[model samples]
Target chain A: MDERFALVGLCPAAEQAAPKGRRPGKRPALAAAFLALMVLGCLLFPLLLTKDPASMDLSNYAREPDGTFWFGTDTMGRDIFAMIWSGGRVSLSIGFLATALSTVIAVAVGAVSGLAPRWLDALIMRLTDILLSIPSLLVIILLQAALGRANIASLSLVIGATGWMSVARVVRTEVRQLRTSEYVAAARCMGGGTFHILRRHLAPNFLASIMFMVVMNVRGAIVAESTLSFMGAGLPLDTVSWGSMLSLAENALTAGAWWIVLIPGLFLVATLLAVTELGEWLRRSANRGQSNL
Target chain B: MCETLLDVRGLCHSFPLGAGRYLRAVDGVSFRIRKGEIFGLVGESGSGKSTVARCVMNILRPQAGSILYRGVDVCDPAQFRANRRMLQTERQIIFQDSSSSLDQRMKVADIIAEPLAVNHIVPPRGSLRAEAAFQLRYVGMDPAYLDRYPPELSGGQRQRVAIARALTMEPSLLVADEPIAALDVSIQAQIINLFRHLQAEHGFTFLFIAHDLAVVRYLCDRVGVLYRGKLVEMAPTKELFDRPLHPYTKALLSAIPIPDPRRERARTRFHFDEAAFDRTGGFVQVSPEHFVLGGKEAEP
Candidate 1:
């Protein structure tokens, strides 16, 4: 974006338009707005696009981008533009599903460890440490291979299962701090149930920590899927994910069809940037009155 | 009204300072609150006043003690579990720092009504919101503050909301641990008056803890004076104030500042002699409704 701004900066009209000192809320809102639009476009991919992304048109195969075909066509004659959007739907779904799964696990572990007695807290933390010692990507691949399925759903489950350890550590630390808070003591004194305290007292207080974690997990899941599919372990080519879309990059490289690789890679990188910017923004706000995770 | 509502016997608590050592916060401190009576525990800072209050409210499990609330031993795990809801519901605590004591994210209405909703008790006033509003009004606060959060309110307002929260359960026992210690001088009197008015009208039993002698004398029915976590004196408030028996109690009373500069400068202030202090001293009754800890041997 800054590069584009610099290019536009050569023109005086554009230089006059770009204002500085936007309030803290504005930048994140712009990023969130872009993400929301991208998500909407991906979700409504079928409704917006007329071409069948999977169907081959041998005569128009491997053509350069033109007025009719925005991202041109891949070697198999599949529309690269349609593939990017449709694959985005899969990528974002994995991000959302994996994020939800990991968040639930993270909160549960964090709450338990944070509120538990010293020895028990040590035990839980040590277990997390052991899990953290092992590389998560390797574990996800091994789990996926052992399950004998590389489908999108199972892949998300595997990624999610492996992703919660770090966030859980953050949550446990946050919860430990929050447990000493007077309101929690007051809530306990009122005879609120454990679940009630967790939901009512603990959740809202540690929400910022969890929000940043959730956003980062979405970004992580997307990258993990892309990496795994770029390798041979992710969803099959038929599933049409961004990772699977990228998996065909080697073939496109051999065929010298640059659009097929560059278009999807550019979209994925841009999406990752927006997601990362939003996560960092949330992290900065969370840090205003809290310890950084 | 004369019946004991809460009885604490041999309360002793210590926090481990690591290195196999303990810092005893409360040691063998015991007092009773009769039904519909105000019982004040007065002590200097680090004198275990808050510890005693926390032990009574069952927020901290004492190392050695039996707290009998309504004649049930709350320290025994099985017995406490059996009557846990009753004990917890009937006993509420108002912590000193109400801004932190009250959930900051929760609105005033939710803060007050949380105990009702959590315990699944049907509100007597038709709805929890109504109960909350009534509690707010009872605490001399308008229902208009219901939508506001704790951070938006002043320290005194937050303390009032804390009181209102405790009152929603219509708790028979209210443990106020230095509730006004964090308030300004003017706000302290307002809160003290509010507490006095609330108790007179509702007859709620109170276990008030404070370092402020004047407020305790004005508000409490009976007073217990603690010196270094030991109960040095116990008597009715008027009796204790007028005729303090122990040397430490005398020293404590003397510490209260006199208003007039003439009397204040000329007043004889008693100082406690640590050489004369004895931890082995047992309670000895010198007069009706009055007891002093020293001048007697340890009793079996």
Candidate 2:
């Protein structure tokens, strides 16, 4: 009788479980392939393509697309093809680094704030509210100006520092919810200290949320870098980045050399789309994995 | 009488509801559990039974109280910290919700071995898996469940795993806060029987908190009735059921339906007068063993 009841209860769950085990969908695979190709191109293009991005050839200046140059030439006669790839490496690196730094700070602050006492939680949350209220773009521009330069390192730092409030808020909420979970309380009753409970129970349970924040932060960082560069507060003029290219292309666009603006703009949009798609796929897979477990 | 294993005196706890207002969850509650005895705390939902258990486990810092575990005042911050590790090893808790109590990500073996690993209780080169398997068997579960996650198990099986995990600590004082409340009625009996068997075999003290008066009568040696964050009555299991002194106790006891329809229909349900009972007076002893709150004053 008990076995029959158990089977009856498990039938619906088993049926629900079937879909999770099915083969991966085509869209996620395409997204993953696209992201992988983009990442690989960004990493290798600057090294393999020997065309100098800074060298000037007056005869080729503002030339249209031809057999010699795949993306034509900019106003300075620099190969737009070489410039795009080289700038991609810097832009991608900034996105990756800034997201990593922000995620680390956010996780630490969120975990502490959520798991700490009422006073500490209130203090951290109030600080987060203050930081969140300020316009992040303004903060980043001011920080860039104060730092005296907008190199990759300082640009990444500025974006990372200003972009952590939302991530912190997300992590704090997740950790607070997990803190009240019976498993966490049980861990405490089992002689586990605060750090042990946080590391073992709370951290693993909330990893999907952290991964989500990481993806969002990366996209935000990329966009913020571009916005700053457009405003002349991101990477210096000599530095190669998608944002820097976009900044330089404004004049080229006015002169009717559309390829210079259009090529980099397409690359920027494609990269962001690929990242967003891949992040969505990853989060869905993570959810499926948890459900299966 | 057996030596007192846990003595809680005037324990009070409250939660802030914002705007300088406080909701008192436990109001000056006091009780004691004898060594190797199952002392059940019975109350309706929101009656603060769990709060009292949490206070006894030192999970919640009570506003004002003294909890003496084996004669050591666990409520004192300095003393608790000084012996925190030892105290933790000696006392463990089992929550009501089996699904929420066990970490879903952890396998049965890891969950069971967690306490042993955390307390550094395992011997050098000792196999945690072996100990976990042993605990599983002790709880009448197969060793095959070692690799299974909590989600894979049924409610009863999950609760059994929770019991196995708590047993791994070999604690002297186990605070089971409605451990069987979430299980199906059919499964509740099995878990309760398992608890009774284990308690007898290990001779460990248990603070069993439950809302079911029948289950408490079946498992606990002594039972305390709680109403509105206060103890209304306390006596040995049989005496408390046979002759409940307090009006709230009478109401609670009468609420338990009899199995036979004829007797159930004829029974008069006791109605407790909440407004009539004054809260200013302390518990008055009506008999040598039983204590009742808000009872008639003793005659000269």
Candidate 3:
């Protein structure tokens, strides 16, 4: 050993208490719990509700909360309490379905581009770049108009189609890098087939890299669906949803019924915040211990 | 069995630098490895040692030359495809950096058993985990680490796992490209000793690439000195160390430090002059097992 290093005698383990790859902070925990409650309530609580979300009561139209109404009524006199959870089913489902569609499209595009020859890869990347360069809202509106009248299914498809470009680029870069990593080359030398390498080595890493994106895509899809509905691009006014409720409540806003829009808006922002926090936590957890390697 | 397990004739390769330029990494280099013998290739950084190793392992295709392993010409795409499984099974390579060479996502057991799983071969030890454990123990590793990922282990442990993974296939030819270069000095000795034991007991053929002449002398049956992508000298280990002929080889050997203070002070370094190097000279056979470049034909 060098005499200089020997004299230092190695610093004691004073910094050991700092720990490595810490757990998610308090905010993520609270967000996770909130999301869990929302999902459970939205998925199951409507089954027990006696009041119909679509039923109207003109006598209590836009009335403040009373003994009979928990969240009061909107301009249509529809019960807001019943509407929130019931509409939650539509909004949440569309969000998740759109997220799934976008994820599938992104994975396929990324993997194909990552594995393709130089020319084809360049072509695919150029297409993604062009799509990313455009404003996603304009594309979504244009797609919704082109796809005919929008419902939950078409709304999700449009939102998913427009949102996949960024995630695909991210996935493509990661796939290209991991595919050429030395270990993958070693596996190839051992005659490990494409499927074996993908399933055993590549898939795990891809999952870690995309977990955050996948969660964020859900939030993006929900927001996109809301924006479309609010702009009268899709979802007929009859079907109940947070966005359609906001649209119907527009007249109520002019009538000085603040609770009509504020309640659903609060729910939307809360869900977005919760989802973002949980996504960040998932991303950190997936990437933990990586630098140590 | 045939004596010559591997033979390379006039191997050459170059990489394009774009704009119609080329970097000649390896030029007409050739050597043969007999079955069960350790062949050491010593060279400085950027001398194309890794490229040569990659060519031998079929990881890189040489532009010109033929590589015959077990009488199969692996350079031909058709021939290689036809015997891909057999060729892949019988030869394996260990890279220098274990961190990059071993899949961090895989458990040690999976990494060790991957070749068998890929080849559809039933484990000789009854089960995959059992086979993995046996190989792990064989390479001087604890079986308890079978469930651990590569990131969880120290550098030496990871290299040991890499060795175990390579050995699991029971390959006939193992190419190690400076495997000990990234290890600590204490770990280097342990790894070298382990390699020596593996060769002496199992009669494993090895292609060991290194610039450390001392380790090459201690482990290699024969030595080949590379200078700027060309083999300058090749001979039996003892013969090469005692009498290095080429200027580059002399300079390379002179750099080894003697342990004794008096001898270390008395030693004079041989300076290699690049300008004096004869690029057109062919290899001349000075003895049955010795060859040197830029030399007159022997009086024989």
Candidate 4:
């Protein structure tokens, strides 16, 4: 009987062939290029522009765009072009730093909660649920108000603290699913410790999800930082940011100096768009990589 | 009599189904695997054969039972923790789904080397590579395939890689849960042969779980028939095949289609009636080395 069953067929003919040549699509490429250029411009813009963004020129207050002031003077007579570049640095840094802090915390908390004992997992998950239920903007505002001042560092910290809940949820779900996989069971049978199974098996499998979360969180942090600044709870008055610039342009809009609001708004919208496009591209590519596996 | 390598006594495990309901996965299962022997646990899907394997492997702790390996009671938490390293080194498992059983992100060489590395049995770099290559060759794959990932390999090749990984630990016992169930028919024979060869060479005991009787009969020395999480019958493979004592065993045997067309057409299968029997009773020994459940008899 065994021989008959054995001789019934050779190897299955429809074996999964290796994936063929893969190339990055055009949209992601353009998005990536744009992001790179923006980052480079942010880094080099302040040095290349001769005027300091914060230096008020009361003599030239509310000047229109000319060769001397590419983006015109704001209500305070600061160079809008230099202020825009300087603001870009602050916004980008806050975004990057906040994303980094949140991702680290999320990965650690998520992995532990997912792989922890039943009681601990329940406790952690309940805590996360509570955090998720609260309005994040309100929490950030309360934190900023309590702290009494919103600097670049404090604003980044506030955004990071509020933003990790979603990432934690994503990682927790992924880890929980991975824990039940046969490989994890096999690892356990082979006498693998909890740390070993988590580090070697679960972590690598869920890395793509983690990466996707980090990128998405960066965009979230940028928006959160801008919102805080727009609401007059962001950086100090002397420090210029896209959000602060928009806030300052409110009075100028009544006087019809539209460039003050439009220029900074354009920067914010373009950066956000680029980031969203890049994140979408990353998610698609990660999915493709997973399907290939 | 051969020395007993493993003895499981009255193993019981259950899963909660919410609202205070429970699904009994393994109920009062008892078995022993002698050294240098292959013990087969055969049952239909969802009959809890895999659960038994997991219980024996210590992957899942049985709510009520004692599992003794080499005369050490592994069911005791203290003993299990104290001897964990030794037990882990001695017992390993090969899973049914080879693709999922392997880490997708890892290369083949890393997958095989993981057990050794995690156990801190780090050989020098050259020797480690050599050892991985050796196991690959032993499993009938070329060394060049080590750099590739699990997704790149065929199912048979992936199973072979899994087997190679298991062998890397040099385990005294291997709990194979439907190891060949996912393979092609032709590949199944080859893997079965590989198991046989490896057993002969290493003298390792195997707890082979499968739903296919023909394959179990080909590989195992002793066969235990599990029906709905209970051991209904157990005997030497040949005896069980020749004279199946339990009604479920008879039904299983009849279900194996004969190769001859006339006999295959003429065969009458016995349908099991679950409502007819008292499943709570213990096994009754009908003959030496043969046991049948749900009959009045003297206890061993």
lDDT digits (tens) for residues A41-126 of candidate 1: 89887678999887889999888899888999888788888988888988989998898899889889988999899999999999
Off by over 4 Å in 3: A1-27, B297-300
RMSD of 1: 10.1
For model 4, residues B223-283, the per-residue Cα lDDT tens digits are 9999888999999999999988788888899999899999899999988787865678888
| Residue runs of model 4 more than 4 Å from their true location after superposition | A1-27, B124-127, B294-300
Per-candidate count of clashing residue pairs (backbone under 3 Å): 0, 0, 0, 0
Candidate 3, residues B109-161, lDDT tens digits: the string is: 99999989888899999999999998877777667888888997888888888
Ten contiguous residues minimizing lDDT sum, candidate 1 chain A: A6-15
TM-score of candidate 1 on Cα atoms, chains taken together: 0.90
The digit string of per-residue lDDT tens for model 3 on A148-173 reads 98888998988888888888888788
Q: Write the per-residue lDDT of candidate 2 for residues A133-212, one digit (tens) a residue.
A: 99999998888889986788898998899888888888899899988888888888777988898888888777776676
- Model 1 lDDT tens row, B85-132: 998899999999987788767889999999999899999999989999
Name the weakest run of 10 consecutive residues (lDDT summed) in model 4 chain B.
B291-300
Fraction of native Cα-Cα interface contacts (under 8 Å, chains A and B) also present in model 4: 0.51
How does model 4 score by TM-score? 0.92
Give me the iRMSD of candidate 1, please: 18.0
Compared with the true structure, all predictions reach lDDT values of: 0.86, 0.84, 0.86, 0.86
Candidate 2 lands at a TM-score of 0.89
